[model samples]
Target: MYLNSIQLQDPNHYMQIAQSSLLPMLKGALYYTLPLTLITFSIGLILALLTALAKISSIKPLQWIARFYVSIIRGTPLLVQLYIIFYGLPSIHITINPFPAAVIGFSLNVGAYASEIIRAAILSIPKGQWEAGYSINMNYSQILRRIILPQAVRVSIPPLSNTFISLVKDTSLASLILVTEMFRKAQEIAATTYEFLLLYSEAALIYWIICFILSIIQQKLEGRFDKYVSH
Candidate 1:
């Protein structure tokens, strides 16, 4: 009878914790996690485009600089990058808030990785496309802006979308730096309730649901883009 009673109470306890924690966790995701991903991805995409252009440029110095940047970022673990920005920087008397530090870390990491994707997309455009643009008396800038980028954007969409989804998951790392994202909220609740498994599971479910919705949106966007390209 005692064992059965304990078993009966366990479900109720977990349910109560879930009911109480869900709203605060959702608010954390909405207010912090989503915004962090969106802002960092936007900044990262711009940096990636510029870095890709630099890498492909004829100027040796520009290519060297871009290559060095990409190499360093790709070589290091992202958690170390976050730690250096948030914690190590204080040793040099440079202190950044948790949110900005997260933004900077994520943006730089994304830029290095995404630059390669963007570069590859640009290169995938046939040499004939450039020639055709030239045949029409289009200058290099005009050709790139009007002809090359449009096709590159199309080719790059799928990879970039995947990167965006990954970033959404990666924002959980921000919690370590004291950013009160969903996972952080989960940690807080778990710490108090001693329901680590339940709260963390709840957080994971929320993340999965968010990612699932994003995946659906990604598929729709891909289909729309494919139709446009086909037409």
Candidate 2:
């Protein structure tokens, strides 16, 4: 009725762990992962739209800035980038906590990549569309806000949703900086109880469930949006 390494009078230590550690760990994941993915991805999408516009702008400086940002983020590993922001920033006067720093780094990285997706979508919109928007007395911003961006978003939805799903899983990496997400909590429980297999497996189960729910939402959104595609 006890683990060899400890003095606990519980016959169902393993089963108890499945209920105790897993249920809350899943909630912790939802707490961090859902907000991080949704907030960061939404902000990133806005930044991406601006960056994409800058990339194609007639102004050379804006174009250069967009290209450089995309190059640096895309060329480097996200973990290293995160370490620099989370750990390296404190070397100077700029000190941020692990969670905020992770969010910033993730949003920036998503922005860089998503900018390209946005740019490609915008570029794919026909010249006639642009001309038509102008003929309708739409200014540049108005045309983009109304005519262009709507189509671009529709075209980019599938890839952008995939990026969001990946971001949900990637949020686990924030645990390395001591964010105490689901996986980190799982590790803590495993270390405390020596129930490594049980706790870790439960953590994996939680991740799968979270991702599955996101997948269902993504599918429903896709179906709803696809109705507009051919019409």
Best by the lDDT measure: 1
Q: Which candidate should be chosen as best, given TM-score against the real structure?
A: 1
* Alpha carbon lDDT at 93, candidate 1: 100
What lDDT tens digits, residue by residue, belong to model 1 across residues 6-77? Answer: 644477788999999999999999999999999999999999999999999999999999999999999999
Write candidate 2's Cα lDDT for 1-231 as tens digits: 356778765768677878888666877777776787787898899889889999999999999998999999999999988899988988897988877987898899899999999999999999898999999898999998898989888888888888888888888888887787788888888888898878878887877887798899988888878997867
For model 2 the TM-score comes to 0.91
Work out the TM-score per prediction.
Answer: 0.96, 0.91
Q: What's the CA error at residue 149 for candidate 1, in Å?
A: 0.8
Cα RMSD for predicted model 1: 1.9
Alpha-carbon lDDT, every model? 0.97, 0.86
Model 1 residue 138 CA deviation (Å) reads 1.8
Worst 10 residues of 2 by lDDT: 1-10
Task: List runs of model 2 lying over 4 Å from the truth.
Answer: 1-11
Candidate 2: C-alpha RMSD to true structure equals 3.5
